[model samples]
Structure formats: C-alpha cells, structure tokens
Target: MGPSRIIAVRHGESEANLAYRRAGERPLVYGRGDDEVTLTALGREQAAALGRLLAALPAGEEPEQVWCSPYRRALDTWEGARAAWGAGPLPLTVDDRLRDQEQGAFARLNPAAVRERFPGEPARREAEGAYAFRPPGGESLADVVVRLRAFVRHLERRADGRRVLIVAHDSVVLGLRHVIAGAPDAELAAVLEFAPVLNASVSVWRTGEGAFELVRFNDVGHLTS
Candidate 1:
C-alpha cells in the first residue's frame, strides 16, 4: 500500500480567536452561510501566503482532498488556497467533526474570565491537554480524539495515494499532531511546549499500520517575505 500524506493547516486568525474569546458557540460564520464574516485584512494576506506555498509543490502532488472545519475562517482559507492547487470549481468538504472542541458555557467568554470563574475546569484542561476536561455541555479532549481519529482513518482509506489538506482550528490542529505522533495520554503534558503554530502554518503526517507519524511540524517558512 502506498503511503498517504496529510497536510494539516490551521486557519487564519478569527476575531474571537485573536481576542481569546470563545468560538464554538454563536454558530460558525465564515464557511457555510450567506450571512457570515469576510476575512480580516491580515487573514486575507495569510491566505495568499498559504496559497503561494501550495502552488510551489511538485506537479501532481497537489492535495487531492480538501477538508475544512465548518467555520468560516477555515472555509475561507481553503477557498483562498484552492486556485494555487489548480482546484477551481472544486468543492471544499465541510466537516463539523473538524470544528474546534466546544467551549461549552465558556464559548463566548474571555479566556481570563473563564479561568477565574471556572478555575478548576481550566486547571484540569490545562493539566490534561484537550482530552481530560469537558466544559459544561461541551466535549472532553478524549471526545475530540475519537472524532479526529475517525476522520483520520477515513482519510487513510480514501487517500488513493494522494495528498490531503485540512484547514481547522488550533485545538484540532494541535490535537491531531499529538495523535499522529503516537503520544500517549501521559504525554499530552509536554506537547504544548513546542512553539505554537501560526495562522496558515502547515504540518505533515503519514499513516500506516493504524498509526500516524509526523513528517513536518508547523512549517511556516512560506509566510516569511
């Protein structure tokens, strides 16, 4: 069986994201609706930069699968990068499963306030990584992994020896990296020590034998002038 590669790219910044406010609530506004957000000026530029990188890849190596979070930001990222891969008129597949893990009652709150109000919850989430803590009415990090794993498994089976691109949020992106790296539950503790991935940065992974391994981690060289 041929090895399959996946390029996981985080979406450009969103207003809530930049503000460190919650995002999973209030409905996703960028990708699916007629009444949604347009990219911020900086976000547009980031998308263009990501597009150029996609354009520079080898011929026939263009991404064959384009999956994105249902969020508007992720949708716009994929849309902006579409032409770079000669994918005009290609529909971007929206995956709710790829949405950021829900923030629960904290969805629209300031991060600091959430910490202060739900002190213990934040501590648990921080200590456990995305898997151990669940916000009220939201999911735990373990919940996210299950959905992400299903998506990854589906992609592996459908790769048909082609590259895949996914545009999503920071939590999802980071969680994927950990999952693919084969880090156990005990290892989530140290995973966040690495430099944070920037907007539009890309990561690469290959899957085999029910496992995934990292080929590249947070490559943003293309974003530099």
Candidate 2:
C-alpha cells in the first residue's frame, strides 16, 4: 500500500539564513557550502521543538517513515527532532534529490553580488525571471519541478498507510507543492510575495479520490510555542 499522508518540513534555520539576514540580500564575504552549513543555535532549538510537536501530533499526523536531504543542515534537523520527539526507530532514507537547489556559481553569494560581479545576469534574470532563468551553473525552479515530479511518483508508489516526513530545504519543500498539488505558478508567487517558508515549518498533503490535496502550507505554529 502507498503512503496516505505526506509531510514536508523545512530544515531549521542555518548559518546560511543568518548570513542572508545579516547581509540583507547582499553578498556575504564568507558563507558555508550547502553540505557544510549547520543549523544555528536557535535552529537546533527549533528542530528539537519541532520534534516534540511531532510527538504530540494526532495519531493520524505522526510520521511513520522519513526522508531527508543529504545536506548537513537537513540531516541534523531530522535526527535532532526525531530523537527529541521520543518516536522510536522510524525508518529514514537520505535522498540527494531532496537536497536544496544547488547554488553553483553563486553557491555562497547573494543576489546583489551576482549582479555586481556578473552585470549581465541581472538583465538575464529580469528577462527570464524566477521560473526559467537559472543562476549560472545552478538549477532553475523549473528543473526542480522536473525531478520532483519523478520523486513524488516514487513517493506515491511506496506510501501505503505511511505518514512520511520529508526534511529538506526551502526550495525542495516549495517545489513539492507544485509537483504534489499542482499549485499554479501565479498562486505560489503571490503567496511568496508576502511570506516565506520559515525554518522548521511544516506543510502537509494527503491523497484524495482523484489527486493529492494540500492540507496545509508552511505551518510553523510549533516553532512559536
């Protein structure tokens, strides 16, 4: 039987998020590689708190199987929260496809720096926009949807009665919305114009008679508590 409930949780805030906050969208002189980045002190707390919340979820929502990004931050969030939640021996699988959108040439840089260093890129981005124009050497949002399409199918095939948790980065989490629920680009962009998926936030979906439906998006009430 395939899994019935699907949950996607963004990894807790990282040094990367802190760096972006400190720099305010400007390039940081230093930043960790995706695999090297770790959760901040608060991030660790958030992850643990998330675990406790999960432990207290209604039986229907508790995770039965887990998959996480191979990146350090995502891996740590899943392990820390699960251990803290007191859930015993749930199976976890690390999937590289769950990794964050690869940063490539801008791996550790921000938007302004990309413009200053590669003046042409800004114009290219303005012309092609977020959905199409990939950062140099990086994957586009469209590219992410392609792979996520395959991954979602893989999930449906194995989900029978399982409540699965996906611990991953923001892009991976958002990409799943498009693949799993067919969120329209305009709808997603409009929502993103006002809000971002916070660290350790949870989004949920479940199979229906016809297709998967979004149960919630970016639910972070657990973190506030």
Tell me the lDDT of candidate 2.
Answer: 0.81
Query: Scored by CA lDDT, what does every candidate get?
Result: 0.71, 0.81
Q: Can you give the lDDT of residue 177 in candidate 1?
A: 75
Q: List the residue pairs that clash in candidate 1.
A: 30-72, 31-72, 130-141, 131-141, 131-142
Model 2 agreement with the true structure over 22-131: per-residue lDDT tens digits: 88866664556779899999889989988998888987779889988899999999888987898889888888889888767877777767777788887887897666
What would the TM-score be for candidate 1 when compared with the true structure? 0.80
How many clashing residue pairs appear in each of the predictions shown?
5, 5
Model 2 Cα displacement at 172 (Å)?
1.0
lDDT of 2 at 4: 80
Best by TM-score: 2
Model 2 worst lDDT run, 10 consecutive residues: 186-195
User: Per-residue lDDT tens digits of candidate 1, residues 1-225?
Assistant: 323778899887665555443443333322323114346667777888888888888876567778888888888887777755555564367888898777677665665667656778767777756547788887776678778878776765666576788898777787787776767867764666654767888888776676566778788888786
| Most lDDT-accurate candidate | 2
